[model samples]
Target: MSMPTLSAQEISSGRVVLRKAHDADRSGIIELFTDPVVRTYLGGPRPRRDVESHLDTSGIENATAKPGSYVIARNGTDRLIGTLMLARRPADRPGHVTDDRDELELSYTLRREEWGAGLAFEAAMAALRAAAAELPDQPILVVTQTANQRSLALSDRLGFRHVCVFEEFGAQQSLSVARLHSFAS
Candidate 1:
């Protein structure tokens, strides 16, 4: 079965569109993840096969089986400029078993040329707003490498408070979590 492509509203800046990713977007998505700067923060380049496999796994056809995730900052021509993923922890996981619906993890990336333009911040805020409307009681969490000042700053500007710093993938990193209740209200 094919996944449905969801259309997201334009953020205040109006330069970006957060929408469901299509299987055809696999190549673009792979480029976004493969950029050296992006890899610096995201860990490293995913093996080509791994990226291919994940794109297949994340195809829109699987929407009903998973939390909402999307390609962010799609241009007017529908080119993917960035990506955002929002998902509740799996029900079988320890965290989800306690509070499944009220919390979600957020991950995003944008082309280097798009950085410093506030597009990432705009997209993230818009996503949070959408999530708040769709899941009013849920909170959003953003985890990133401590060295990723760009993302960390964006998170802070968007109201994500610092929660902790820990090691992930064998590297010391910062973990920030935010509650969306205030934004919703």
Candidate 2:
């Protein structure tokens, strides 16, 4: 059978909803890559013109084109606040929990204004729970830059244990792991 997945699934929780990107999310998705604070650990913000150059309505939904890709928005509205992804760690990427396979990786980013309200954590938990409920039991990974204390703290709060440190994107990074089964009800 094909692997169980969150591919194109619309998931929601009390405060956040993880849904496919849409036309209304274009500006928010652009802001995610162009805003300085939001892209601080993500190779710094791309030039706004450069970021805007490649996007069109079709490109917005490109964020959710694959299984596990989602635009994080408020529960009752389409306004985008952030992005969350529960997908494979590319084999070419530095961090991996398994030798022969690309492990599921959790990555997220939120609008700076929404940072202190626990929205990132809320969005992540919602995605993780959804993935765990559908996918096979396996190790999920969280790789964050060492300088990003906020992300590392969030990983801890989500129950991932630090595994190692490695260099990526010109900086030291930390890798952590949590089993998929742990999130299942």
Candidate 3:
């Protein structure tokens, strides 16, 4: 089944426009991943071919088949300032009976220059809003290296509670999770 196309808005921050990524955003996305500061938190600069592969594999057409994903704040000029992904929990092992599909994993990276500008928080909040509306019943999660102070701070600011610590990708990591409760009433 095809997913609905998400609408992108020009979110204003004084004079900046934080919107979604588009077809012409490849080069800007590549630059964000290649920056040293960004690579420090995320493993390393992913190979160019690998990035190209990701773009091809996770395009808008595949958004519904998997958990939704998006690029960072874009302007009317079509510049990419960050990236984010929300993936559904994987299926259980063959013999395991416990599988929670109502959970999603999130990861994001922003241009080094944009650090501390609140763009990351803005982008994350946008994703959370979209997910709550589009994928109800699922809680959102963010796992980061324990030493990644920036991400840990962002998680705390966004209301993700620390749940556990685990080792993964050869590094000690903290797993945080949060529920999306409706406060509309």
- Which candidate tops lDDT? 2
Clashes of 3: 2
Clashing residue pairs in candidate 1 (N, C-alpha, C atoms within 3 angstroms): 2-61, 3-60, 3-61
Model 3 ranges off by over 4 Å: 1-23, 48-67, 91-102, 182-185
lDDT of 1 by residue, 1-185 (tens): 22222134333336777776666666777787667877787777767777767667776434223445667645577777787777654444222212433357777888777788888877777777776665655456777888889889988998888877777577767767777665663
Candidate 3 minimal-lDDT segment of 10 residues: 93-102
The lDDT for every candidate, in the order shown, is 0.67, 0.86, 0.64
Location of the lowest summed lDDT over 10 successive residues in candidate 2: 1-10
By descending TM-score, how would the candidates be arranged?
2, 1, 3
Model 3 lDDT tens row, 87-128: 654444111112443356767888888888887887777666
Model 2 residue runs over 4 Å out of place are 1-4
The lDDT of model 2 is: 0.86
* Model 2 Cα lDDT, one tens digit per residue, 17-39: 99888878878888899988888
State the lDDT at 124 in candidate 3.
Answer: 75
By TM-score, who's the top model here? 2
Cα RMSDs of all predictions? 5.1, 1.8, 5.0
